[model samples]
Every structure is written in C-alpha cells, then in structure tokens.
Target: MTKIKICGIKTLNDALAAIDAGTDYLGFNFYSKGVRFIEKEVCAEITSVLKREHPKIKLVGVFVNSSVDEVKNILDTCSLDLAQLHGDETPEIFAQLVPHAFKAFRGVPTDITGYEHKDGPAFLVDAAVKGMYGGSGVTADWSAAAELAKKYPLLLAGGLTPENVADAVRQSQPLGRGRCLRS
Candidate 1:
C-alpha cells in the first residue's frame, strides 16, 4: 500500500485529523518565511503529544535553506524523526543528516546523483514553481516523476487532491503521496 503524508501541519487538531485519516507521516514546515511555517515551540508541543498517543506515526521537519545546525537543533528540540530538505541544500549538508534526512526536489532531476540515502523515503518531488519552495498548488510533472520513480523511492507532492490522486498514483507510481491539506 502507498504511504500517505500530510504536510504543513500547524496544529494538534490538524495532526490528529491526518492521523485519523490513516496518514503514515506528518510534516511540519519550519521555513519561517513559508505560509505554513510553524514555530519550534508549537511543533514541539504537537509532536510531544503525538509521540505518546501515536507512536506509529512518523514526524518530519521541513526546512528550506536552513543551516545544518538549525536543522539539527530543531530536530532535537521538536523531537522530529526525520528532516526534509526542501531548498537548495548542499550534498554535504545532506550527508550530515544521513539516515535522518531526505531531499525534496522542486522538479524531476535527471538522476539521484548526490542524494543516495539508504534509509527513509529517499526523495520528494514537488512542483517547480518560481520563487516558491513548495505548496504551490500546481501539479507536479507526473510523466517526468514516473521516469524518476523507476530509479528512486519517490514521494510525490504538489497539487494532489482526492479527485486526482488515483491518476497521480497510476502515472507516477510513487512509494507515497505528500499533501498539504488547507482549510
């Protein structure tokens, strides 16, 4: 079965809702400039409750152009299980967070060249919206993602909705789907 991850979780209510909906992972956006950005204290409070109530659910911290120290600090402070590097983070930075971190690409890459992690979701593919890191509401390149999926364990994000999810799955064949539920 394909795993489901609900990104941009800002409140305990949203987190619980995603868990109730059978989501496998919950993403907390830490990019301060992003619309869905959540404070570290708020995320910590939410994650703490989740760890006790829903240990099976994995927690991921989403960062964009943040320093390795910042990511590490947040991960430890927030009790996050993994990190999702969604900006132009270097391979060196990725290496430092190996096994605990995965990269999120704006679009389909020609190859997984420097992002060869042996654990977790591996990589996430999001829409390549100009000047935007994610949650662009634009559909990802499913055709291109299909080709990339053949090589990597991909998590497809970007314009996914209940209506088009089946088709997205059929076309991209990703290991899972990541979505930011907005209300």
Candidate 2:
C-alpha cells in the first residue's frame, strides 16, 4: 500500500485527528517562515505525547536549508523519525546527514533532474513556490513524476487530497514499481 503523509500538522488535536484517520506520517514544520511553525518546546511536547500515546505514527521534521548542527539540535529535542530538506541543500549535505537520521529531499517540477545521492534518504516531490517551502496546495506534473518513479522512491506531495489520492496512486504506479503520494 502507498504510504500517506499528512503535512502541516499544527496542534495536538489535529495530530491526533490525522493519526486517527490512518495517516502514516505526521509532519511538523520547523521553518520559521511557515504559518504552521511550531515552537521547539511545543514540538517537544507533541513529540513526547506522540511517543507515549501513538508510537506508531512517524514524526517528520520539515526544515529548510538549516545547518547540520541546527537539524541535529531539533532532532535531539524531538522524536523525529525523519528529516525533510526543503531548501537548496546539496546531495553532499544529505549524504553527511543521512547517517544521523532518516532524510528526505523535497523537489519541484524543474528540480527532478534524476540526480539523487546514493546515501540520501527518500524523495518528496512537492510543489515549489518562488519564495516558500511546501504547503503550496498546488499540483505538480504527474507525468514527470511518473517518469521519475522508475528510479527513485518518489513521494508525491503537491495538491494531494482525499479525493484525488487514489487517482494519483493509480496514475503514478509504474507496473511493478510503487510511488508514494502525500498531502
């Protein structure tokens, strides 16, 4: 089955609701620019709660081009199952960080150059805004994503909703290969 990751989780109530709805991953935005940004203390609280109450739900820390030390600091404080790089981070950065934690790279339509780091973690293909990270609520070219799926474990994350997830999965699936679609 394709994994479902619900992004922009802000409150404990919302997190629980998403978990109850069977979401495989819960994303917490650490980027200060995002409206969904949660304080470190709040993140710690949420992470602790999730660990004790809903251990199965994976916690993902959404970050921009933050330093390795900064990322490590956040991960050390929270129970993050993965770190999503949504900025201009290089493959080398990902390689160096992958050993410390699970890594995911966010890409836009033009960014899908079929170039991926050997040691990089998963790829999250999201809609790219001019001056913003994800949560754009826009749709990416599914055809391009379909083509990229053959090589990488592509996770579709742009403009996905309950209504369109099934179709996205069906259209993006490449025969025996599987791609992930996230909202």
Candidate 3:
C-alpha cells in the first residue's frame, strides 16, 4: 500500500482527522512563514497528545533553512519521527543529520543540472514555488522526477489531494517502485 502523509496540519482536531483518514505520516510546519505554523509550545502539546493517543501516526517537522541547533531544539522538545528540510540547505547539512532526518528538496524544472547530493536519508521532491517555501499545491513533472528517483529514495509532494493522489502514484510508480505517496 502507498503510504499517505497529510501536510500543513494545524489543530489537534485536524491532526486527528488526518489520522482517522488513515494517513501514515502527519506533518507539522515549524517554519514561521507557513500558514499552518504552530507555536513551539503548541507543537509540544500536539506531539504529546498524538504520542499518547495515536502512536501509530508518524510525526514530521517541516523546516526551511533552519540551523541545526534550532532543528535539534525542536526535535528535543517534540516527538518528531523525522525532520524535513525544505530549503537551500547544503549537502553537508543533510550529511550532518543523516540516518536520522528526512531531507526534502523542492523540485523545479530549470535544468536541475547540479542538484546531486550524497544519498543519506529519504528525500522528497516537491513542486517548486516562486516565492514560497512549500505548500504551493502544485505538482512536479513526474517524468523529470523519474530520472532522479532512479538513484534516490524519493517521495512526491505538492498540490496533491486524495482525488489525484492515486493517479500521481500510478504515474510515479516507476520512480517510487511501490513506495507510499506523501503530500
């Protein structure tokens, strides 16, 4: 079965609703710019509640160009199962957090020539937005992503809803190889 991750979650009720919908992963935006940004204290409370009430749901922290220390601080405070990097963080940054983090790269159609990075943790290829960090609700070129997915463990994101996710999964099956979809 394809794993499903619902991102941009805000309230605990929404989180619960996603979980109830059989979502495998639940994302919490920590970036201040995101509309679903949650306070650290609120994140802690939600994490606590989720851990106690719904341990099956994996929790992910979405960040953008944040320092390692800051990421660690959030991880220490909340029960994050993974850290998602959604900025221009260097490979060195990904290396430093390897095996314990989920490094996400926003995908764009401009060449993507020098976008190679050493394979560390699971990576995501999300649709690129002009002036936004993420949550653009746009889809990337599945054909372009196919080439990259050949060498890396990839998860697709951006503009995905329950309606189109199945088709997206089918189109990305070659890249994903039956892996779950995350949007």
Candidate 4:
C-alpha cells in the first residue's frame, strides 16, 4: 500500500489533523530559507505532543543543504523519526545517516548509481525549479519519475493535490506521497 506524508506541518493542530486523516508521516521543515521553516523549539514542542499522543505516526525533518551534524542535532532535539535532505547533500551524508535520513532530488537524477542501496534510503522526486529547493507548486515529471520508480522506492512529491493525487499515484506508483497542507 502507498503511504502518505503531510509535509510543512507548522502547528500541533494541523499535525494532529493530518494524523487523524491517516497520514503515515509528518514532515517539519527545518530549512530556514524555505517558506514553511519552523523553529526548532516550536517543532520540538509539537513533536513532543505528537509523540505522546500519536507515536505510530513518523515525524520527518526536512533540511536543505544543512550539515550532517545540524540535521542530526535537529532530528534528535525535535524527536523526529527521519530526515529528508532536500538539497545537494552528498551520498556520504546519507551514508552517515542511513536508515534515518533520505535524499530528495529535483526532476530525477540521471545517475542514481551511488544513491541506491539494498533497503537503504528512499529517494523523493520533486519538480525541478531553478534556484529553489522544493515547494515550487509545479507538477513533477511523472513519466520520468515513473521510470525511476521501477527500480527504487521513490516518494512522489511536488504539485500533489486532491484532484490529481490518484493520477500521480497511478503514474508513479511510489512507496509514498508527500504534500504540504498548510491549513
């Protein structure tokens, strides 16, 4: 079955609502430059409550080009279960945080040789927007993502909505799907 991840959760109420709606994962953005950036303390408080009340729902910390240490620190402090590196982080970084962190590539990478490993980290395929990390609100290349999904456990992101999610799922067939629901 395809899993669901609600990204950019800034409030406890929103997080809880997403959980109630059957989201398997909640992504809290740590990218200070991004629009949905949430403070560590605030995310921590939200995460603490969520962990207590909804332990089964996984919490993901979204980072953009942050150092390995920074990601690790934030994940530990906020009680996050996973990390989504939405930048140009090296494979070595993923290696260090294996099983805890994964990579997000924009528009699908031509060469995914080093990134793929046996039951290792899953890759998130998002729309490629110049000078942007993510949250572009542009539809991703479904055809390309579908080709990649044939090999790896990809998480389809970018431009997913209630109207088009079914089509996206049908086209990509990813392990999961991520969308930012700010309401």
Candidate 5:
C-alpha cells in the first residue's frame, strides 16, 4: 500500500484529522518564509501531543537552507522522526543528520551525484517552480519521476489533489505522496 503524507500541518486539530484519516506521514514546516511555516513552540506543542497519542505516525520536519544544528535542535526538541532538507544543503550537512535525514530536490533533478542517498528509503520529488521552493501547486513531470522510481522509492509531491492524486500515483509509482494547500 502507498503511504500518504499530509504536509504543512499547523494545528493540533489538523494533525489529528490527518492522523485519523490514516496518513502514514505528517510534515510540519519550519521554513520561516513558507506559507505553512509553524512556530517552533507551536510545532512543539502539536508534536508532543501526537508523540504521546500516536507514536506510530512518522513526523517529518520541513526545512529550507537552515543550518544542520538548527534543524537538529528542533527535531530533538520536537521529537521528529525525519528531516526533509528542502534546501541547498550540501551532502556534508545532510550527512550530519544521516540515518534520519533525506534531501529534497526541486523538479526533475538531472544531477544526483553527491546525493547518493540510497541509504534512505526514498527522496522527495517536487516541481521546480522558479523562486518558489515548494507548495507551488505546480505539477511536476510524472514521466521523469516514474523513471527515477525504478531506482528507489519516491515521495511524489507538487500539485497533488484528491481528484488527480490517483493518476499521479499510478504514473509515478511513489512510495508515498506529499500533499498540501489543496482547495
């Protein structure tokens, strides 16, 4: 079965709702500039409760260009399970969080030389909207992503919705789908 990640959760209610809906993963934005950015304290509150109530759900912290130490601090305090490096973090920076971190590449990455993240289960794939990191509602190239999926698991993102998600899943064959900002 394909796992689902409901990202950009800001409140306890939303978190619980997604959890109840059987989403395997949940993402909390830590990027201050992102629309879904949640305050550290607020995120802490939400995760603390979730940690006690639903320990099975994997919690991912979304970060962009933040220092590895900063990300570690938050993940430690919040007890998050994984770090989704949604920035230009070097392989060195990513290695610091090794065994618990995964890099995110915008659009169809042509060069994955230094990444070599075969250790981790999957990688996040999203549209490379210029000037926008993610949550752009711009669909990515599924054909390219499907090809990548042949190598490893993919966390398919970018412009996913209830209506088209099935098609996206069928085409990309991702290990999971990360979705947000649907209306």
Candidate 6:
C-alpha cells in the first residue's frame, strides 16, 4: 500500500486528526520562514500527545537551509523521528544526517545526475517556486515526477488534495504522498 503523510502540522488537534485518519507520517515544518512554520514548543506539545496517544504515527521535522547542528538540535528537542532537508545542502551534508534524514527537491531536476542518495534518505519532490520552501499551493510536475518515481522512491508533495490525490498517484506513482494540514 502507498504511504500517506500529512505535513505542516501546527496544533495538537490537527496532529490528532491526521493520526486518527490513519496517516502514516506527520510532518512538522520547522522552517522559520515557511507559511506553515510551527514553533519548537508547539511541535513538542503535539508530538508529546501523539507519542502517548498514537505511538504508531511517525514524526518528520522539515528544515530548509539549516546547518547540521540546527537540524540535529531541533530533531532531538522535538523528538522527531526523521528530518526532511529541503535546502541547498550538498550530498555530503545529507550524509551527516543519514539514516535519519530525507531530501525534498524543488520539482524535477534538469539533469538526472546523482538524484539518488546512497545508503539513506528517500526523496520528496515538490513544486519549484522561486523564494519559496514549500506549501505554495502550486502543483508539481507530475509527468516528470512520474518518470522519476520509477527511478526513485519519492514522496510527491505540492498541490496535492483529496480531489486530486488519486490522479497524482496514478500519474507520478510515487512511493507515497505528502500533505499539509490546514488547521
């Protein structure tokens, strides 16, 4: 079965709703400038409840352009199970966060070189927006994503909703889908 992840969780209510809805993963946007940005304390509160109430839900912390220490600190403080790196970090930096890190790309790459990371970290392909990290409400390139999906186990984000999720899945054939909770 395809995995479903709900991203941009900001409150205990939203977190619980997603978990109750049978989501496999919950993403907390820690990017300071993101539209769905959640404070460290709030994330902790939500995670605390989820861990106690719904231990099966996995928590993923989203970061953009942050250092290794910054990501590590937040991951530990928030008790996150995985880190989604969505910035300009090199593969080497990704290596440092290996086994606990995944990369979110800005749409499909012009060149397919090195798209796959060795030994760790799956891929998340989102819409390519200038000066934006994620949650832009813009649709991603599904045709291109479809091709890449065959090559990599990716999470397709950007402009996915209940209405279009099936189509997105049909076109892209990603390993799973990633969503953001509005509330």
Report clash pairs, candidate 2: none
Q: Candidate 1 clashing pairs?
A: none
Candidate 3 lDDT: 0.70
Question: Which RMSD values do the candidates have, in order?
Answer: 0.9, 4.2, 4.1, 1.3, 1.4, 1.9
Candidate 1, position 2, lDDT: 84
Count clashing residue pairs in model 4. 0
**lDDT (tens digit, per residue) of candidate 3 on 3-120:** 6777777778878887887777788888997777878788888889999998887788888999988888897798788788888877777667655576666673343333344543
Q: Candidate 6: where is the Cα deviation over 4 Å?
A: 110-121
Q: Which parts of model 3 are misplaced by more than 4 Å?
A: 108-121, 174-183
**For candidate 4, lDDT tens digit of each residue in 76-100?**
9999998998999888887888778
The candidate scoring highest on lDDT is 1
Q: CA lDDT of each candidate?
A: 0.93, 0.68, 0.70, 0.89, 0.86, 0.85
Pick by TM-score: 1 or 2, better one: 1
Instruction: Report the alpha-carbon TM-score of model 1 versus the true structure.
Output: 0.97
- Give the alpha carbon lDDT tens digit for every residue of 69-160 in model 1: 99999999999999999999988889999889999999987766778877878899999999999999999999899998887788999899
Which stretches in model 5 have alpha-carbon errors above 4 Å? 118-120
Task: Rank candidates, TM-score, best first.
Answer: 1, 4, 5, 6, 3, 2
Angstrom error at residue 172, model 3 = 0.8
Which has the better lDDT: candidate 5, or candidate 6? 5
Off by over 4 Å in 2: 99-121, 174-183
